[model samples]
Target: MLKDRNITLTVPAMPEYVDLVRLTLYGIASKMKFTFEDIEDMKVAVSEACNNAVLHAYDKDDGTIEVRFAFVKDELSITVRDYGSSFTIEENKETPAMHGKSIDEIQSGGLGLYLMQALMDRVEVEHGGGTAVTLTKKRQRTEEPA
Candidate 1:
């Protein structure tokens, strides 16, 4: 069995730095034999997490975002952490009803969480002094559709 491996990257909470996190994810996930489509999904999810930290976690540009990539038992878990602000997520509770609302009626926030949950196999958030969003994707050995 392959031993669990981890890679940690810390970047300034800026839009420009998000790409570096994606690049690092691509390298590690590719090495673990992730399919291109899956890798792309992961990249988008990770970017959203990093973007959230950059936009909401700090008052200015001094804060940093820490991304941790942990590979264990054929699963890749990526955690994006920010130490600036914190939020809460009550378990097993649905968000405010957005159903049947016009596109203009919906707000611009909280969509990143939805997007991240849709892309990854599992998404978890923890916050007290900071927020850490952990996105997990499991590796599968299957042929990609042509």
Candidate 2:
């Protein structure tokens, strides 16, 4: 049996550091036998979370973003946390005007939450003094030839 494991990393709140998160995720997920498609989904989900922290966390001051990866049984849970300004998903919900508008007509931002939810098996957001987004993905088992 594989023992449960946790890996944590802290990076400066910057756009460039998001790629480091993705690289770490890929390395760990690949070792756990996650499918390529699933890994890609996770990468996108994690990237979105990191991007949110880098862009919205810390209004006028520098801060750090903490990423925690926990492996339990067949599930992988990733938490991206930032100790800075906080916001709610409701505040970023899509507007009615954006419904019928074309892609170019619509805005370029505010899709991170949707992307995270769509790509991950579960997404939980907590905020008070800061924001924490936890994304979970379950590993799919493959049947072996008998």
Candidate 3:
């Protein structure tokens, strides 16, 4: 069975804090034995989520972004929350009427949310007093030699 561990961090809602989140995620994912590619994907997804919160969550520069990291065995889950705009995960996943269009053609800013959903095994968004995005990804299990 996988063990569950969690860490929480609150930082200023600024672009500079994105690197702090990336580093913290790298450490947790490394301990969970995530592959290099998986680590890369997680970093990108987490960064996107954080960026969204920083850009949309606060009108003044006084708010903070709360990041929570949870490790469940080979799976790592991240939650990014901000007290700003409200958004739905389902709404963000819709594609324009046109199919096979390049990302540039889509023109909607929710592409980051779409990419996060694609990269993570699970993605959920909650909006109340704040907006929170939960992302989960599992590490590939390795076989033991008999």
The model with the greater lDDT, 2 or 3, is 2
What's model 1's overall lDDT? 0.90
CA deviation > 4 Å runs, candidate 1? 90-105, 143-146
Q: Give the winner by TM-score.
A: 2
Evaluate residue 67 in candidate 2 and report its C-alpha lDDT on the 0 to 100 scale: 98
Q: Candidate 2 residues 6-92, lDDT tens each?
A: 999999999889999999999999988999999999999999899888888987548999999999888999999999999977788
Q: lDDT per residue, candidate 3, 6-90, as tens digits?
A: 8999999999999999999998888778899999999999999999998888888898999999887677889999988677767
Clashing pairs in 2: none
lDDT of 1 by residue, 21-88 (tens): 99999999988888899999999999998998999899999999999999987799999999988766
Cα lDDT, all candidates: 0.90, 0.90, 0.88
Question: What TM value does model 3 have?
Answer: 0.86
- By summed lDDT, the worst window of 10 consecutive residues in model 2 runs over 91-100
